[model samples]
Target chain A: MSLSSLPSVSTARSTASLTADAAALPPRAERFGRALLGSLLPLCLLALWALASRQGWIGRDLLPSPGDVLRTTETLVLSGALFHHLAATLARMLAGFLIGAAAASLLGALAGSSVLVHASLDPLIQGLRSVPSIAWVPLFVLWFGIFEASKIALIAVGVFFPIYLNLASALARTDSRWDELAAVCERGRLARFFLIALPASLPAYITGLRSGLGLGWMFVAAAELMGASQGLGFLLTDGEQTGRPETVLTAIVIFALCGRASDRALAALAARLAWR
Target chain B: MAEAVAVRDLVVNFGERAALGPVSFTLAEGSITALVGRSGAGKTTLLRCLAGLLAPSRGEVKMLRGQGRPRIGYVFQDARLLPWLSVAGNVAFGLTHLPRAERREAVAKALAQVGLSGWAHARPGELSGGMAQRVAIARALARAPDLLLLDEPFSALDAFTRRHLQEELRLLLHRVRLTVVFITHDLDEAIALGDRLLVMAGPPGRIVADLPVSDTGGALLKRQVLALLEGSGEEALQSPTLRVLAAHAG
Candidate 1:
């Protein structure tokens, strides 16, 4: 809560705080207590959910009891079905993210660095970004034929737009004074991009990547729904077709957990890499 | 002293209007030339031109260049160190051409020169304004440039920090065989740091006066520079004899 605890970025406060005794951070136990406090609302919501299911406030067909969903999850795990489905979806998400991020970064750099490139390419990119990613699913299935490639291609399309948007804007917003420094130092174009533009845009690029990953998760469900046999999306469809609400609830819970976990991982990585 | 950088009737245009120029001057190698002017006088425009960050619309800037010579080292008003880089990495930014060992040595030497050898691994965001400016100086010195260009490098610091840096910078430059083009509006700072003074004036900025800092007559020179900036005073600008003589060692 002290100024010293804040990141020393603003020149005035940072300078003044330079001589001010650094305020000690809270003890480990107190810090841990604060973290636990953050989960209070989610835990309360889960308790409400359990009570509603227990009292049959929602019909069993509409909302399965929490116990039923947990039992279903355990059965799926014991049968190794959950692992197989979850692993398949994670693999697809990773592949889509890697492909999407690479392609977006290349095109984004082009657009951001040159006004000519932005003029020539931004309209098309923006137009494409405006299209709902799910709209591409049918076309991708038709072209790649309901295989892993089609699913990956669809997710990649979803991931591409946000990362591309963030990176282009971030690069555009980079401080021009560094470019002046590069010119004075006689650095080449490539050097300027790598030395100044790249690091300057990294925090935003990571934000874009995190959003792209979430979008990829959304499309992964849609991707698997396009006739996947072994995935969480397939499990959802199977639960619905078989009229088992608990199975569907189990899949939803897993999706929530996985998405939260991935985002948290990325946030931790950003903390390490953002401003050094 | 030898000629290190020459500006010949240089002019820069921001659209149709002239922002600087028909400005001409020569930097004596190993000498510190302080350019003094009012805020709108375009000292920065001229410095940018000399630093090759801006191109002259008319005339040119010719620097002494040859094999093994590095490009110009520039320091802006603020520290401007890349926040992500460590002190050593920031100093080593422009030294990528050197071998790894030589680069390390140069970074160490530069940091040491600024009295920041112990803080080589610290982040710029962690430093005070004075410390950050010292790191900026180290970054410039690491390149071992023959010519260094500074645009009011210490103007953002507190008065005490500013005065302290001026003294430290003067001593540091004295130890190196480097020529400097310093831009500042403060006549006291200019006189304290420079061997020669160039006074600039106007929208289409031009150097209206040139004078040397005489060790015996600091107050007199300060008054003259103030008057020149105020469009009144000494005729040293009118005579070729004074202009040539001002380039000599202080």
Candidate 2:
């Protein structure tokens, strides 16, 4: 029961040393493991689906088999219809999310640093943040019509609060001692912000950005579902109208896949840039 | 001799509570002074005021006598390094006015003087407590300031590291002849490191004692001087450490 003697300190050290050595050489093994995991995940999901369909675990009409969904997806891919719809969704998400995140960071820094600014605007922002972006759909429609403006507005609203709150909280947590230290060092106010405040707040800002992207994806889909002629959501609506369960499942699968890919890409980019 | 630091009627108050002097003190040019006191004694407060990190509630801190630029270097107890910066970057943070090559060379020389040549690229988080403190000292050293203010710079360090750094500090001061004011609760540290010790005590801070110490001064002289400032305890003169420990224990 006791295998305490199996790996001594030296043994553990050598093993760690070997791993470190391998890690120093381009990370190919790590990349291969990631690729293998990526490939296996969908395969496992498909196998589960096939088993379910064969046994009639769920009604075939409601939940199409992976094969049926794949056929629909392949057709859409060949026709480049999925690509067109995906591009539209991505464009809206990126544009709206960037605009919301930038404005929030700037305003958040201002509010966080100045008590007067925070006092003037904090109650209004808190009230606005509490209201869901989806609840604004009717108002947005009236304000900007059913075009892309409404969708962008909804997505921007969804993404704004998380980024703003996170950034503001981060800036608020900035130690006054650091500012005093900077003054002692004779650094200017702008230099102090760039060197200390910005770097210190980066981790919190990144956390906010990550959460905002999730909300953004959710809002974009909801906006499309409520009103859109051509999108993945529209395709789902089209499938429902046509009475094609397979096409509906294909559209849902594509939406999930794109969302996962975007999140993964974001995580990868965050890994590269984030300090801690 | 030029006046390194000239202060007149320096007063600092935390609301109604007084922290430091309405008293006056002059720091002679290129001399080391130690500020000593019990806990909550305003030693650190006085050091901070001199460093320009804190403005006096009422008083003038004339760092330079007339026209020359007055650069003040600082070494804090915790070695408050920027976690994200490499040792070289942290050391060179204040030296932007210098050319890039000169700055790098200065950082390199400062690190070498602190016996941290190998740790130039390491992050502060990656260093030991002693190493981190050394880097902080190197950072101040690199600034080549007119006045160096250290607040318990080596109190947190291990005994061996503390002794080594004390020696290093003594040698660095000899080479650069920088004016320094160090704060410490330790009497031995004050005696060993200071050219003059200014002991401040209680309520509205007033200088209780001003004792001059020299390299030639023996342990007996140090004990006698500290004993004089600490007030009467006939038995306390035998051993200063034991006396201080006994007083604290009681």
Candidate 3:
């Protein structure tokens, strides 16, 4: 047969094979089992920790037994202190994150869209970003005092840089080809910004938000450590001063769990925003 | 009224370098003009000038609209659809000035025209390349433009999809009868679709030749266009070669 008249054999074969391969895949339960198996090492580490504690291989003063940590957790939960501290930390994190994210996105967009704004502000912003969040703590404390304002300011500062840099770069890098379409469609400058430029930069903006929130959590701890009556940071410091290793371990665990949970939540949000 | 687009001594320069034009042309309304050129030939520069996306360093482009400003639609080399929007939403983008019902009706009609009526809710990322290009065409159609500018709209597609889309575009033009200026690198495409073909050439690009495509003389015209583009200037023209050289020099 001539080339044009040949049957589309390869196409048909590929489709059939794809269908067969999909059908041959294992069930959902087996996939779940595989995922669970992947976590075996971390579970083993926990088992080892319990074993070491029961045998007293490590001194109780330096490293509290898992049982001791659990008992402390129970006491804290019953007295509602754990929930109180967690709630306070969450509130501070949310407030600072919203403020910082809002400012960064607005400024970043301005810088990205206009050459003048970028030239005027980018150097200073970049310079400030290089300074560690912890280094700003003393200055923030002096400026805002030892109140909630200082803590919030510290968290907000921590959250600002990643979001600003990411969003500004994203906006600047948005495809110029779309501008031609906008012109032909007779869309005005403002309309193009809202409908095209902003939406196009969303994936980058979402990424910046995730990174900012992670840093926001870290800064909140630093802020609370320096001064403040409540929060996880305070609990850690207080545990140290009181010689309660169990309380310190409990606080660290809570911080890790909360950080992971918040990161996961932000990731889900980013996925939803980046549905395209 | 023939509503022609008259370009007068247009020149575009980037920094110290000229990109296109110390040339002039007029495209009569309701006609398709295919602009064929090599890469970096400034066909895109000319199109952008016409679309008012880029300002020419020198010269004026006048579109003789009968009344108000003429509505213009443009399709780029790539689909260039907004990824966040659905097919229908992208089509409806230019129709925001219209009333809601009118916009919806326009979008539906455009989608139907492009054979994408059922894919209205699909995101741009979900569609295949051909489908996305069709959506881009639908977006241009939804505006009901008097003039449509296409910059290599089907050049990225495979042969089968390109031919299919070319046929569909021809049908669309026959029904709409809008003025069109299409850019292409394919000589056959220019011959098949254009009523008039403009060939561009040079490091500092300019339109080298403008010829009408006669039904029986497409092959001869293609040969001439190829010769001109390849810088075989003397061989392309049957008239005196020295005169053509003098004209180019001047």
> Which DockQ value does candidate 1 get?
0.30
Over A1-276, each residue of candidate 1 has an lDDT whose tens digit, in order, gives 221222332354445445433333566888799889998998998899899988889998988888889999999999999999999999998999899989999999888888899999999999988887778877887898878999999989999988999999989888988887777667788988887898899988999999998998998898888789988999999999999989998998899999999999998888778883
User: Model 2 segments beyond 4 Å from truth?
Assistant: A1-48, B64-69, B96-102, B225-250
Tens-digit lDDT track for model 3 on A226-254?
A: 97789998899999999998999999999
| Residue A207 in model 3: lDDT | 85
Task: Choose 2 or 3, whichever is better by DockQ.
Answer: 3
Tens-digit lDDT track of model 2 for B25-132: 888888889887666667777888888887899998887642566787898888888876788988988787689999999999989877778678866766667678
lDDT of 1: 0.83
Writing each residue's lDDT as its tens digit, candidate 1 over B76-190 gives 9988888888889889988877899999999999988887777788777668887888888888888888789899998897786777788878888878968988998678888
> How far is A131's C-alpha from truth in model 1 (Å)?
1.9
Q: What DockQ does each listed candidate score?
A: 0.30, 0.20, 0.30
TM-score of 3: 0.88
Candidate RMSDs in order: 4.9, 7.0, 4.9
The per-model lDDT (C-alpha) reads 0.83, 0.78, 0.83
Comparing 1 with 2 on TM-score, the higher-scoring candidate is: 1
Q: How many steric overlaps are in each model, in order?
A: 0, 0, 0
